[model samples]
Target: WVDAPNLASRILSMTQKRIAHDWMHCYQYAPVLIETFVETPRFPGTCYKAANWTWLGTTKGVGRLGNSHKPTLPQKNIWVYPLKKRFRQILCSNVQ
Candidate 1:
């Protein structure tokens, strides 16, 4: 479960390598970015940091179906990893 120290980093590195190599070869389109959220109260997001993921910020503590005015869930930390060097440009480009 990658609960051990330093194990998260190893697993993440292997996963990223596989995604860049094996997965990309299998798919026609490659992913530009990967994102994940960590529950603030339960996790400090240390693994993500170790794996070089950027910490965007914390969520508003509102669930998808909950009212924005009243948060019904715990706030989570937003993390993102850019797989491509031009991920920002690609994401911002309007190519419809």
Candidate 2:
């Protein structure tokens, strides 16, 4: 876990650089966005917020195999990081 102040921003910057320079080349495609979840009650997603990630919402307390009518897991907060400035436009575009 990162404890140092402002370290999350540095780490996020390095990760984005690596993804653009290395991962994109290897995968042959640039990702528009990245998403992650933080377990609520245990974490407040402070690092993700510090790194400029958006808090989309919270997930329903349902596991992958569980039914929506009966949630069987802890709810988590959803966070997203958009790589592109026009990520929403790119994601919604139908051009291939």
What C-alpha lDDT values do all the predictions have? 0.87, 0.85
Top model number, TM-score: 2
Clashing residue pairs for model 1: none
Off by over 4 Å in 2: 1-4
lDDT per residue (tens digit) for residues 29-86 in model 1:
6778888999999999999998999999999888888866687899999999998899
All-Cα superposition RMSD per candidate:
3.4, 3.0
In the range 4-95, model 2's lDDT, one tens digit per residue, is 86777888878876775575689888888888999997999998998889999998888887656676778899999988899989998986
- As a TM-score, model 2 comes out at 0.81
lDDT for residue 1 in candidate 2, whole number 0-100: 80
* lDDT score for candidate 1 against the true structure: 0.87
For model 2, what is the error of residue 48's alpha carbon versus the real structure, in angstroms, after optimal superposition? 1.1
